[model samples]
Target: MWLTGLLAAAALVLTAPRWLPARVVALRAKVFAKVNGDNAITFPNAQVGPERFQEVYGHPAANGRSRGAALSDLFWYWLSPGAEVHQEHLEAGPRYDDVARTTRALLSGPADELADAAARCAGRVLDELVTGRVTPVRLRDLMVPVWAEYCYELVFGEPCPRAARDLIAGHADDVVTALKCTGLRHPARRERLTRYLARRVAAGDVRRPLPASLSPAERVHYLQGTFFNTAVVQLSEAMAHLLLALAQHPEVADRLRRDPADDRYFAHVLDETLRLYPLFGIAHRITTGEIDLGGGTTFPEGTVLCFSYPDYHAAGHRDPGVFDPDRWARVPARAAHHIPFGVAANRPCPAWRLSPLALRAATAEVLRRFTLHSTVTHTRSLPNRGPCLLVRADGPPPRHLAALGAFLRVRDRWEDVWRSVVQLVLGTVMVLHARRLRLAGRYFETHDTAGCPPGHRPPDHRERAE
Candidate 1:
């Protein structure tokens, strides 16, 4: 009996690697279903390849299709009703050459310098908002130019050209004109930029193929789009959500203000905010070949797969639909899995590092100078629709109240630790029990070989013994 038990244990240990992956996959699918319900997976018509998948929403696309058609419609509807005519000229999809260059520049810069630059930009914007007496100032409009200028400087090693700056800051028509001048058909505009880029390259400042195989015109459009998407669109949306969250959760705000340098705390706030309102809600993907997604579901090659960050995070989160930053402390693993920018493995945005730095710097600066207190209104915008923040600048709250907030935060952290410890223990027990059951089953299966009646032993077993 002892020998049989020992053999059973060995068998269970040896086979674990074979079964572990299936168990994990099943568990993930079960959890997904529990939080997102049965209709979590959707098949849209548009073929958004891996390169472009990072840009789509996780939710179902419009007209009961994938977001591909909807995005194409939006581009034409908003930018130019005649986009079809220039469709041949447009780069097949988002080009990453310039994005790579900008990211490299940002990463090479000193962290402190980047943080200081972001803070200064935020400071300048705050000053304008306060002193301009601009009632209900369009926060989006104000943030766009500031961030665009910063990004332009990073890429060009200088301030944005006066003409480009004027065009970007001007009315809607001017913005349209600026976009048009960046097309291949515009020789004068294209030639001017080509000359500028040539000079930058000659000075050993910018890299060769300054635009990376793209005509000067297309390069300008690509750079402008990339900056606007990352800085103007996503960053503004994230900032708006942060302000809204602060207004909604004053306790969080109080705690954040108490220790402005605590990057971890700020990160938790940002993580929770993004979880509640992810900038890019859904990420689209396509399978390269036949793939099994557990639960007997198999996706053939070319199938469109959409994964929602909100749904994925909410499923694992303690309370899927609540605004709780404290949860991050309790479930650090889940917090770590948070992908507000994009998936870590897949083509994550090159600006992943710089974006967070900017956010943290801007957040710290804002918390120091102002007190936010208001909700926001939602709008219909593709990719992201940051709330309209109605905020006002006020002096910091009392130090005593902040101290109380700090104490509560510490108490919360302790509670989180306790909960996590309990969970670990429970999980360990479950795993041990499962192992015991598997060992018992293995023991029974080999019982015949271990001991059998003299004549009842199978011929193969008797021969082996001989």
Candidate 2:
């Protein structure tokens, strides 16, 4: 009976989001709203439970006071994961007297350099894949290292040394790690990188001005952090997605190849690919005071807010699930809301400007060189799971074969839809079972002590008033 109830409850929670009435969802959304503010909403983390927060930040003290004074610090630390260490390093550094000038100095470079590097790297990787020169070659593996090398060259004015690659690759476990060092897990590697960067600074090869406030150690950390956080990490994933997108939509690929100089077409395709498979699926922000997000939904101060790219696109756009680059042309306003790099207001990626340029160059080169055949496989991970495509260079299929391939792609999309529905159903059933058991247990605890079996009740509770 207990097992049966548990199963039923599990199914309900899993399916609740899908089946819950629109009004209920809206009301729930309102509950997250700030008092007296319009349109701003908050995620109290109530529905999903507090486990995630506790897991990331550790549990609050027993008396409910945090170890830190500033809530924003905790919030930022939570959102960016490993950024606090880098932020600390940046803060400890000598403040650059002219931040704007320093920023300009950091960003200054001939755009063509990045483009040339991207084209070269893309050509080499695609050639290897086409010729079967490398076995078990994954697109991301090739792209990450190649892009890393290019970025190192662009930033440091020389090729990336083998040691730097080893250190960066070793530490780069995920997107956050790419941005900042989370801990002292790789102390030896960190030390080596510090020494290497310090030497580079001394040589005066790096054109980017170091803030006078930064100590030598902080300067090293800042350079390493900035280099890693820039184009390489995000662009690699975006480039992978673009390849898969082109392979699946050969019509678009053909169009791109035919008119390689059409910047609008390239931008549309990149934008659409990002929309379909964003590098980071969601962006998190904490409310500062009350915010009116319009529609009578206001979020209170300290509320943890999430902007899910997928959810926003799905709710706002027509046929949001489909990969149609043409839609961007029709709905220019929709494209404005696309935030693949990060939100502009809060934690924007420093590489946002260069990333698109590099992607455009790399993608154009790839399409020009080879006709791609690709299959996208999705992992079972929730939320963050984006499209991962397995691609092979098939040269170019014959016209008849290409038509047949397009048909199959459409059919495959339908199959994916059905698969998602079936999975949702199964997940919903499990959540329902879990919910049922929870309610049953609550009832049993509250009013049915007389019916409790021996050894089931707590020792103190087992002793009746008599």
Candidate 3:
């Protein structure tokens, strides 16, 4: 009777997935939040909804990058090598000004020239991958190499050398894989690129000069952190989300595949893709000064504001969960609860203008050569790396997608059980290391400053009041 009771309990526990998947996911997130204790005001609450997203985001005082925060430590840990010097993380100062100017120069050129270069690189990438078979592929893996070469050419003003491409891909893949928590950080992989970048800097091979204030080693770290790491990883992830959407919606793929010239429709698809799976899950800011939100409600200095991009994009939209590109036809993308590039007043993405143009060209190149199809589970956190089948444009349609999809549902759910545990363990260790090392904290506490770090900049009325 004891054995019988034990066996019945085991069976019921095994069958809990049917009813407990959502609970498991929620519990996993709860564990993460507990591990990385935050002190921030989350957006989309009753106090701040989509209507005020831009107003709060664009507020002059809400521009602090990383100071007095716990979550910033995790971000710094993920983007090591030179997270402190990365433009996105740097406090507002002369150094940041110089770096931002240089970034603009690198992305500067004739619009047609930049667009054509992206297409050429993307076309070459397709040449190496496309075969006349319904081959299964990981979409992120495919796009990383493509963006690596594109960024290489932008920096070096030449076609990317084979060796450099491999180093870039290695470091970028390791960084992003670790970021997604599907893998661990292999420091050796990141260091190899660091050494390679040092050589390139020594050779004076950069197309544009980096900031003069930065040392040779700092310059190498800057190149590695910015062009190689963030630029490559973000574009690769963005393209993966876009392609996965097209794969799931064959009708949309057919329309774009048949008419590559339809820029209007293609733009709509990009808008909706960004809306559903925003690249940034949460963009946190440290309050440099008090923000008076009217009605006697205000956020004081040093407070953290965590902007929820996914939640904001879902607000004020009908059928927000559906991936219908046609919705952009009725609602102007500007008026919609969309901030893919972020508010202009704050630190909008440096590549804001160039990214869309390059993405549109890349999407056209991909659809021109192949028709995409996938039945894998798509989510904001695509830990499975977006499994899909790529069929040549002329190839016959494949079969057994329904079976593939069914298998994916079961596999992904089970994988989540193990993945959540891994994330919990890894996230705790990384967060602890970040806190102990005090990368950003050290900078804030020690960097030379008369009153406050000049990097933090422009004190407001609250400072004078104090």
Candidate 4:
């Protein structure tokens, strides 16, 4: 049994390179054609490639479909109210009833409230980055923890459950494993979920006396796990989109810095980025009953259906294949045709509002501070592109730092020293984490062979591997 466990562990880790991202991307691509169906639109096979993703929103177009569609779906799912069908579950119970309400309260909350909270969260980090007090690598370290904390608060509500937050903060691998298993075959998801649950329970991070509304099993599914994979996936994808825009048009950042009130410009850049590279393509639903998606194609009851928001949004814009924020600016703000998150028929993201607020706050703060450099090596995901982790490029000229330095000069010297010390300590901790992953990789390679000397080599501490 133990040897079998080890083998299973190896296979689970191996799947991360393909399985995790594919789970999200595959769903997006499969639904590219069904986003909208007015029954009047038709194309005579102009769109080519996989027949599965051909007619986006029922309008047939040829030659372009990519991960950008998925990112748009993620954006919509995270921001706006879901489609009519999605609201049904929310109405079914009080537990979920608050999902949309709380989301709206947070995003469309009082402008003062949003500004104060956003500033508090971003203040120090932005200051550090702008002043060259920390490197981009160090900024990533600070940003991930801060962003994680913020997201947990949004998802679970405040006063944020300390144990749940700590479990996520300390055991990222467990969270990643559970997320990867979400839509897989039952036993596979159950196997990974069980291990994750046991670890949290052992750490005393999960409480006893499961909620009265849940059986012990149901409680474990909903409460014990965290959405750490989504956190990293979305954050990295958002960061990439933001950076890519900055790299392509230095003027956009300049305009943003000079007139911070022009929130529309920031939105345009974000929209363009998503259109070019979405995070999760489309969301899936097994049809509960027979329904006509117009155009004379009636999907029978129980048929799996999806709507491709990315395709619809891309199709409505000019040169859907290129990266251009200007095209985004040309569209109106509340246009349903943009469908970056999810549209009327197929919205799936529960974090719709929370994600955009977070992304906007983070993006606005960063752009107002530093000029990000361009990289020759780009990262391509199933849906988006990020800076190659291995590449280093010269960032935009350093003029912004001098301006920011003058602004921060009001603080006393001692306070500045303390902040720098704290940042340095955080940087060291990140270095140690990287070292741990390196060691684990080497150890796994060394022992993963036939006839190796074996006796309890402890399952490489599951949570950190993610």
Instruction: Output the number of the lDDT-best candidate.
Output: 3
* lDDT, model 4, position 240: 57
Off by over 4 Å in 4: 1-111, 124-143, 155-212, 215-236, 293-296, 333-336, 344-350, 376-385, 388-466
Q: What is the C-alpha RMSD of each candidate to the true structure, in Å?
A: 24.5, 16.7, 4.8, 17.6
Query: Which residues of candidate 2, in runs, are more than 4 Å off?
Result: 1-82, 85-104, 124-136, 161-163, 173-192, 292-300, 333-336, 342-347, 378-466
The regions of model 3 sitting more than 4 angstroms off are 1-21, 35-38, 399-410, 449-466
User: Higher lDDT: candidate 2 or 3?
Assistant: 3
Worst 10-residue lDDT window for candidate 2 reads 59-68
Expressed as tens digits, the lDDT of each residue in 100-219 for candidate 3 is: 877899988888888898898899987887665666788999898899999999999999887899999999999898887667788888999999888888999999877765667877
Residues 1-466 of candidate 4 have per-residue lDDT tens digits of: 9999999998876654445434534543233333322221222123321243323333312111111122223222221121111222221233233333333443345545544455445555445434443233322333544454554444333433445434444433323222222211123333453455545544545322222333344334433232343454456456655665565466876676677767677778777777666664444333334545366655454343344445544555567777677775567746524545643333235555556666667666666555554432232331112221211123444545444334333222223333334333443343334334443223325432211224423222232244
Q: Estimate each model's TM-score.
A: 0.56, 0.59, 0.91, 0.51
> Model 1 over residues 57-129: C-alpha lDDT tens digits?
3312211122222222323322322232221113122223233444455445777877777787777767756
Model 3 score (lDDT):
0.82
Error (Å) of candidate 4 at residue 83 is 21
Lowest summed lDDT across 10 adjacent residues in model 1 is found at: 59-68
C-alpha lDDT (0 to 100) for residue 366 of candidate 1: 72
Candidates sorted on lDDT, descending: 3, 2, 1, 4
Winning model by TM-score: 3
Worst 10 residues of 3 by lDDT: 449-458
By TM-score, rank the candidates, best first. Answer: 3, 2, 1, 4
